[model samples]
Target: MKEYSIREDDLTGEAIAALLRLHLSEMHQWSPVCSVHAMPIERLRAPDVTFYTAWDGDRLAACGALKQLDARHGELKSMRADPAYRGQGAGRAMLDHLLGVARARGYTRVSLETGRPEPFLPARRLYEANGFRECAPFGDYVADDFSICMTREL
Candidate 1:
């Protein structure tokens, strides 16, 4: 099995920034600007959020974030696998790391908002495989044509 060095990250460096930019660009392309729920770097830096990255040696393979919503709830954010590193396990690695952190933090539930477009199918599949199921809108999110809300209980 392949092992990746996944850890809480500082969200610095050019590679990380480029990955984030590409993530946002793709999100905007598939969904209306208003329906885009992907967080900006600034929002990911909020005190309630913890960001992480999966590294394949010196390369930034992927990144994701867990945002605290309440005492026992969290929201997944900004999960993206670098295009250059696609087909690798970086996205799954980052996700498992984030879920581990959430479990350690005693989060009883974790939720996310993603697009309903074709581009988001792989992500939806990943989440579903990890036990997240389509659910009603969570946190400040509302049900909409372009939005797909999912949640899982710890």
Candidate 2:
């Protein structure tokens, strides 16, 4: 039986530290753009960002965040599923939960920036399956062959 729960919370210093380490050391092993490597976890804990962690029994299975860019806009951030649970639909579950939160909060649009690498194909596919489409860069992102920008209107 697969049981899991998703909830928004302030990823504590310890949890955030561990996540940052995995994102930097493990994920970066395959990703070329490791910009999130330098971001302090406190940034995600900011007033505008709502971060969520998914747990399967006390173990963290996945996590993601929705950052309120403005009144009607939000940006997806730090979407990662534990490598151990990668193929179990945890990522998709986290994504659907985040989108529901954004929609319920009245966001008019949601955008995300993901890598353009072979390892990122699944991530991009997940977004596309949920209706995200390629778009011009927004927020602090710029045009980079390695970074693919995507957006979806609510």
Candidate 3:
């Protein structure tokens, strides 16, 4: 397997935009319109959101983001691995990097909202393996049947 590196990313790049579009498309397919929480590229560009991408040299392998919700809390957003890079640890690497960033920023907790459907099982599993557990909705999110919220204490 090729080695990949994760770094802060500018979402305006063409390759990054394409990856985000794919992530949004997948979210829409598996989640109801009202429950789709995937952030748009424009939203990810907001000042409070720090976006990162994993690259295998010239190839964009995955992406994720951390959105500051408060002094002690952060939310994970827009995590996705390129189809070609799925199961190759790209998503895990991106997630780990974002978690590290959250810790470095002095966040005491990290939370995420993801779909509850079959398509999202892998993501939930990934978070679970990383010590995230089911939690009530945090920040501005509300409890919903289509969404599962998870959190971890940093």
Which candidate number would show the highest lDDT if scored against the true structure?
3
In model 2, which regions exceed 4 Å deviation?
1-3, 13-16, 26-28, 31-38
Clashes of 1: 0
Clashing residue pairs found in predicted model 2: none
Candidate 1's residue-wise lDDT over 38-127, tens digit each?
A: 888888888999988888899889999999999999999999999976667788888888889999999999999998888899899999
Between which residue pairs do clashes occur in model 3? none
- Put down candidate 3 lDDT per residue, 1-154, tens digits, no spaces: 5578888888779999998889999888888999989999999999999999999988999999999999999999999999999999998998888889988999999999998888999999999999999999987789988889999999
Between candidates 1 and 2, which one is better according to TM-score?
1
Distance (Å) between predicted and true CA of 108, model 3?
0.8
Model 3 / residue 134 / CA error / Å: 0.3
Off by over 4 Å in 3: none
The models' CA-based lDDT, in order, is 0.89, 0.82, 0.91
Residue 19 displacement (Å), model 3: 0.8
Residue range 18-133, candidate 2, lDDT tens digits:
86668657556765644432244778788988888888888788888898999899999888888887988888998899999989999999999888778889899999999999
